[model samples]
Target: MKENVFYGKGMGPIKRDFPDIYEAIVELNDAVYTGKVIDYKTQKFIALAIAASNSDDRAVKKQIQSAINEFNATKDEIMDVLRIVLLTSGMPPFVKAVKILYEVME
Candidate 1:
């Protein structure tokens, strides 16, 4: 199954709405692919942290589950990422993201 919240459609609206931000993201992707600054596992952890920090429930759940499934990360590892997000980004978003992870994992 192709698990995309946008249902496999491209993020055209986002790109159109936030051209500069979207361009930066695209550039970052290119740099990551070219420079290899971070490994896949570390990138996955960072993604989970960012998603949790932003309180993007869908992204948090999806990335957490994907990391567990793809990288064999344990619940402890997920919690560790959340903990870091909580420290840096505060508690409300972390709480919200953790609730989603709990529901999905349960």
Candidate 2:
């Protein structure tokens, strides 16, 4: 399987210490990201919005980076996603996500 951007700093230890669980998670991720109907880029944007709505700064940054690196997503595209976040999740998460987005862009 390709490297998963969702695997953060602890993944190496998890992969070494719990191979079965690691593989299960990777397989699940692959299955979910199949792009059968919704394209991967759109899926990623949805994921980004979810992360932002949850006020997860690290996840927001990671999603933004992954979208840009994997799909060449632009600031405008990210801003559009944040606009949805702002509407649905309110200002705190939206502001936090925007801050993380700018940091990632920089």
For model 1, how does the per-residue alpha-carbon lDDT over 1-106 read when each residue is reduced to its tens digit?
Answer: 2122221135677688978876876776655534266667887788789888888877787788888787888878888988998899998988997787788778
Model 2 residue pairs with clashes: none
lDDT (10s digit) by residue, model 2, range 1-106: 1236553778888899999989998899999988889888899999999999999888888889888988889999999999999999999999999999888888
- After superposing candidate 1 on the true structure, give the runs of residues whose Cα lies further than 4 Å from its correct spot: 1-35
* TM-score of every model versus the real structure: 0.68, 0.92
Evaluate model 1: give its TM-score.
0.68
Best-fitting candidate, scored by lDDT: 2
Quick one: RMSD of model 2?
1.7
Worst 10 residues of 1 by lDDT: 1-10
Candidate 2 accuracy as TM-score:
0.92
